[model samples]
Target: MTTIVVGVLGALGLVSFFHLGLFDLSSLLRAASNLRQFILETFPPQFEILPALMHAIWETIQISFAGTLLGLFLSLPLAFLAARNLFGRWVAGAVRLIVGGIRTVPSILFGVIFVIAFGLGPTAGTWGVALYTVGYLAKLYYEAFEAVDVEVIEAVKSTGCNRLQLFRFVIVPETANTMISQLLFMFEYNIRASTMMGFVGAGGIGYYMVGYVQMLQYQHLLTTLILTFLVVMTIDYLSLRIRSVITVAKN
Candidate 1:
């Protein structure tokens, strides 16, 4: 009875909040006609630009892969230093503060800053993506590190293992699978993000996407969207397969 009461209250609260926010169905109903017109303009995708778009797609993939790898490399040490069980609260707290600060800023803002510094190119996009990855991955890595089994650490210490040996033989081995899974997840996320890189003048397929929209070339935009969708779907599929293999191996 208590659970049911709480659920009903929560539902009521959500509805009340939406009402307070001025939620209305009229706008949606009105937009249906606009949506129909927009669809008519977007059909029959322009395939003539396929070659150029393919190159842009490849570049997007490259930027995502490079950024994710760079972030992973940087995150490993940061997370190691931030692990409370390994480094104590003071060290972990300081590192967490830094990671939190990084995470506070959005990746697009980083793209803007890097675009200014690097002057509009995939270089800026890659760095922006890397920094974004570092912010999330470092936090994740340290949490995983701290979750290491206490008994295992103690057993390793009993063998006269040094800090490095303990980490290598116990902590790392335990967390290896998790690290790989996280890396793959981040890579998938970065791909989606890299598509927006062009909005900030950082190069990617998004540059063409922006161009198409500005030029009111919805047909071209539709082509880009389709290609992007296919690419993202393929990456998602591959990541799923990789994660599945890792899960099976771990089991």
Candidate 2:
């Protein structure tokens, strides 16, 4: 544990005994006045823009749902191929490399690229969300695939089943619950990201958010933020409930 702690601190550059340091907490104190001023100006958000805000919220939800589904459709196959136990290292390694490369880039960066191609809308945001989902969920799914009982897989194999039959009967059933759980988690995350994508003209609430900020319409900004917070919390609650139901049904 001492070695692990030392390694962590060293990596954090917390001590010049290990490497150079750049620790600075004083700036936050300096920014306190600005933070206070911003908060004071932004409270009790305006409800005048409720209609527009609702539309934007809907767009964000749709973008997130579509993007997550797109990722799920593609990742399911990739997950199977990337499962080391199923496909061996030769296949898994290549898929991992591709996935790892995608994961290296941020979703916002992907949005930047897709915005240029798809031209300033939810399509770009969806593409960005999809790629990130692929990168993130494929790895998760492959891990889940690896954890499936070997005996069950072999028993299915022994039935003279082809690869498709094996995947259908063995892998899909074993991992369906895990995949659903991950899907809900990813959809929640995608909603947050898709909202941010609007900052880049990729479409949805972010556009309104950035506009409100630029105009110093802090009340409107506050309102938008409040709405976003409510949406997130609601989704989180619903997702928790759904997952609980799934878990109970499984048990």
lDDT value for candidate 1? 0.91
Put down candidate 1 lDDT per residue, 1-22, tens digits, no spaces: 9999999999999899787754
Candidate 2: global Cα-lDDT?
0.88
Candidate 1, TM-score vs. the true structure? 0.88
Which residues of candidate 1, in runs, are more than 4 Å off? 1-30
- TM-score, per-candidate, Cα-based: 0.88, 0.89
In order, candidate lDDTs are 0.91, 0.88
